[model samples]
Each structure stands twice: as C-alpha cells, then as structure tokens.
Target: MSKETMPAAEAQSYELAFHVLPTVAEGEVAEVFQTLKDLITKAGGELGVEEAPARFELAYEIVKHLEGRNRKFSSAYFGWVRFTVDPAKVEHLDEEIGGNKSILRHLIIKLTKVEEENPYFFHQAMAEQGKSETIDLDEEEAEATTATDEDASESETDSEVTEDKE
Candidate 1:
C-alpha cells in the first residue's frame, strides 16, 4: 500500500466580506460582484452561496485605504461571498480585491471546516428582529424625511450666512 495519509485534493474554506462604496450605483454593484465571482473561478475556487447586498452604517469612518489612496467613508453596501480555495492562491485574491476601487473594504478568513450554509444567515435572522442597521421605510415616509432634512439644511445655511455678516 502507498504511504499516503492525507488527501491531496483538499481545499481551504474562506469567508469573504466586503463593502462596496455607498456612492456606487446598484447596477455597478452587480457588476463588481460578477467580476469577483469570475476572479474566484479563474483562481480555481468554488463559489458558494452569496448574500444579498444590504445597507449598513460603519461604526467609524474608514480613513486608511489601500495603495496610496486615502478616503473617509461613513457607510457602505455590504455583501458576502463564501468559497473554497487553495491556500497558495490567497495572495492573488487579496491583490484582486484590494486593487478594486469599487470595494471600500474587504476581509478574507480561513475557516477551520467546511460550512455549506449561507454565511450571513445569522445576520439575516437578526435583521428580521430589528437588530440590524438596515431600515425599511415606506416610500412616502422616506420622501417626507428627505423633505424635512432639506428644510433643516436650508435653515442652517441661512444661519451661517447671517453669522458671516455679523
């Protein structure tokens, strides 16, 4: 018998969570995710369940950015991707994600075991209980809130002008 004790075909599990800039359009967000999926496949990784994008507030602004760019971001559209990949190719994945302008932030963690279920399922369940930052407001309510904010902004500008002349 051969002296092989381990399987050579084993793959490593990883959870990828990323935030696309809030300024990015919905269609652009789809395109960004598609590009990521393609990258994963090209790297010989198998993509698993994807979590739908959701709006969330950041605890603090992200100031330090990749490469030579620096930006302050308060919020972003969050998304997650689950995949099984070889450890040797992780560096490539990092470069691919880090170089993308559309992605404001990203994280990749090696898992100890394979988990086939959606990685964001627990978060979704919490969101249903109103524990998440995502707010689902009716159209009319949202419009009303926007109008109120505009009025507040106008008043603030007017006060600022009066203060400048004084």
Candidate 2:
C-alpha cells in the first residue's frame, strides 16, 4: 500500500462508550469489536484502549427462553472504546452501526476541544488556583475570629469593673 493509503498505526485519539445486547455471548465480543475496528480503519483511523465490561441487571427481559432451557435472561453488557477516525468519515460509521445486530447501541462522537486536552494538567491548574483561594479565605476568617474574641474580652472587663464598684 502507498504511504497515504496504508492504515495509520496511530490516529488522533477518541473515546467511545459502547453497549452490547444481553443475549450476546462474552466469547463473541472480541470478533464484534474487531468488526468495528476494521470498519474504522478501512475508513482511515486507529483503535485504542478497550475498556473492561460494566454490566448491570436489566430491568426487563429482552427475549424469553424455552420453558426450561436456560435461566439466564436479565443482564446487559457495556464497555468503553477509544479510537481515532478520520473526522470526515464519522457519519458513515453511524449508518454502519445502525444496521448491525450485535450492537444494541453505539455512538461515535467527537471529543470536545476541552476533553481532547489533557485532564491531568487542567485539574492541577485548577487545584493550584483553589489552594490560593482557600488560603485567602482562611486568613480572612482568622482575622474575623480574632476581632470577635477581643470584643468579648473587652465586654467581660467592663462587667468586672462595674461589679467591683458595687
């Protein structure tokens, strides 16, 4: 393949939260995910981390089993996928996913400029600002408390003097 036509080993990163239907088998997940990866790569992109499944019991059944075939009928599988895709081809992806049976639901979204930025650095900057703000507030509260204490002491002294006269 020519350099431009060759699949990119790495693409601008993205994050996706994906969910699977309850009836799907765990063993089949990898193949299903690969299908999505191929689709993105063929359209020009790269896939990243595959997050662990996050499952919860379903509120209602999706399919009913035979009278006594199996008791497994009430849970769903979900996970997150991070990948990079040519921004232009993203629309076509929605169409492919819409037609898929294995995928209960999927959404391919562009990360906001903010989310695409490093969160660690952003949070650190905010924390430094917060630390300075907290110090300023503490100093103000200390001054107020000291002033209140002095006022209380002065009132006690005044009462003591009046009692001495009586």
Candidate 3:
C-alpha cells in the first residue's frame, strides 16, 4: 500500500502508574516526574490528566535489583499519568520506563472508553471519605451520650416511685 493511501493508526488512551524509589530525594521527585512526562511526549504521546507524585507507604515491601544488589522498600512516591499514543509506540515507552533506575515499579494499561472520559482522583476521594467518616463518628458519639442520659433519668424515677410506695 502506498503511504498516502494507508490509514493512520488510531491513537489509544493509556494510563501509566509508577512508584519512584524512596531513595530519590524529596526535592528531586518533581524532576523525576518531569522526566517521565518528557519521555511520553518524545514518543508522540498527548498528555492528559495526571497526578503529581506523593509519598505513601506501600501495602507490602517491594524489592528491586539496583546497582547489582537487591534493595527492599516499604514506601515510595506514587503517581500516574494518562495519555494517548499510537499502539506501536507503547512498546518503546515501556522499554524506556523499565530501564529507569529511579522508578521502583511501573505499569501501563490501555484505558477503556469510560475510564478515559472520567478519570478518578483516588487521593482526593480518600480525603473526602475520611472527612465524612469523622462526621459520622461524632454523630454516633452524640447519640450515645443522649441515650445514656435518658437511661439515668428513667432509673432515678423508678427509684423514687419505689421509695414513695414503701
């Protein structure tokens, strides 16, 4: 097929989630994030929604082979980026990310249409959920206090009636 007659490959949406090694200094974390974005751009990716890296404890220890030795980590800076790129370019991006020493682990997933249209902000939702839980706890404590007061008054009334009858 002639180049002019060939149909252009459709760009597909993808999300890249990564955990940066804790060894990376706090000040340099942003630099690492920028470098990742640059790599995607170089691969002809159009960047979309993204969350900046934030330090968080991992669910379990992660071991990575670095500098000819195995290193274990309990926490890391985590973040994700959404982008659209030709399917053929994804492999190249994956290989580049795999070679980066600063990244402890990374994953790239092709996004469904629903996911691409509505990006979820996990951290923000977690914060909001925490606030709502706190409010619920306070309300439960208040209800308990009111119930205790009602029980105390009922017990006092019963004792007075028994004394009067005697």
Candidate 4:
C-alpha cells in the first residue's frame, strides 16, 4: 500500500518496568528516572501512571556487562511507567533504554485493557504487608509471655504443696 493511502498506526498501551543499577547514587536516581520519562515523551509516547523508583533487594544477583567488565548486583531501585505509543516506535524506545548504563534491566510489554485501567503499586502493598506481619508477630510474642507466666505460677504452687507435706 502507498504511504499516503495507509492509515496511521493506532497508539497502544504499554508499560515499561525497569531496574536501576544500585550503584546509582541516591541523589541521581531521580535524574535517571526523569531521563527515562523524557525518552518516552521524545519518542511520541504519552505518559500515564508511573511509580517512582524505590530500593529493593533482588530475588537473585543480576549481572550486567558494562565498560568491558561484568558487574553483579543484589539490589536495585525498581519502578514502572505506563504509556501509549505507536507499535512501530517501540523498537526505538527499546534501543534507547537498552543503551542506558544507569538501567540494569528493563522490560516493555503491551498492556491489556484491564491492566491499563487498574495499576498495582508494589511498594505500597509491600509496606502494608510488612505492617500486618509485625502486628501478628507482636500478638504471638504476647501470647508466649503470658504462657510462661502461667507456667511459673504453677511451678510455685507445686513447691508450696511439697513444703506443706514436709
């Protein structure tokens, strides 16, 4: 088909999940994130929901080859951004992100309609889970303490009975 006759490509929803190298100094992390967002905008992508990068321990060590040497990291700052762009432009976006040294790894996936509408905030969910776990531990510890106190009293009662018999 001739270029003039072809319809313009429709923009599709996509999400970019990326892990920033842990070596990136805390202060510069924001700059790196902004750069990534800028890349999306520059590529004719419209930005949508995004989560700021937050430090997290990786499930396993990740090795990245940089400057002719392999570097291993056990932790990194992870975040994700959602956007919409023509499918044809995704390849360029992928190349730009891959060439970035600050990013340890990244994945860009076409998002389903449901995923685009309801976003999950990983960090917030983790924080809430941690709080609930702490509360459960506290309750268990209190129960253990109460049980020990009762056992101690029973032991004292048994000694009193022996003394009376003597």
> Which one is best on lDDT?
4
**TM-score comparison, 1 vs 3, better candidate:** 3
Clashing residue pairs found in predicted model 4: none
Q: How close is candidate 3 to the true structure, as a TM-score?
A: 0.74
- Residue 25 in model 2: shift from native, Å? 1.3
Over the full model, what C-alpha lDDT does candidate 3 score relative to the true structure? 0.82
- For model 2, which pairs clash? none
Q: Which 10-residue span in candidate 3 carries the lowest summed lDDT?
A: 1-10
Candidate 3 lDDT tens digits, 102-165: 9999999888899888998866776689777744344556653343443454466655544344
- Model 1 stretches astray by more than 4 angstroms: 1-9, 64-69, 114-118, 131-166
Model 1: weakest 10-residue lDDT segment is 1-10
Clashes of each: 0, 0, 0, 0
Please state the error at residue 140 of candidate 2 in Å. Answer: 29
Question: How far does residue 15 in candidate 2 sit from its true spot (Å)?
Answer: 2.8
Tens digit of per-residue lDDT, candidate 2, span 1-166: 1012335444445565556666667888777777767777787777765554445555555553434653445666666566677655666776786567766656665555686663233334545786776443445666542434434544656555443443
| Tens digit per residue, CA lDDT, model 4, 23-114 | 99999999999999999999999999889899998877899898899989999999999998887788879989989989999999888788
Q: lDDT for every model?
A: 0.72, 0.58, 0.82, 0.83
Q: lDDT of model 2 at residue 8?
A: 46
Tell me model 1's lDDT, rounded to 2 decimals: 0.72
Using all chains and alpha carbons, the TM-scores for the candidates as numbered come to: 0.65, 0.50, 0.74, 0.75
lDDT of 4 at 4: 21
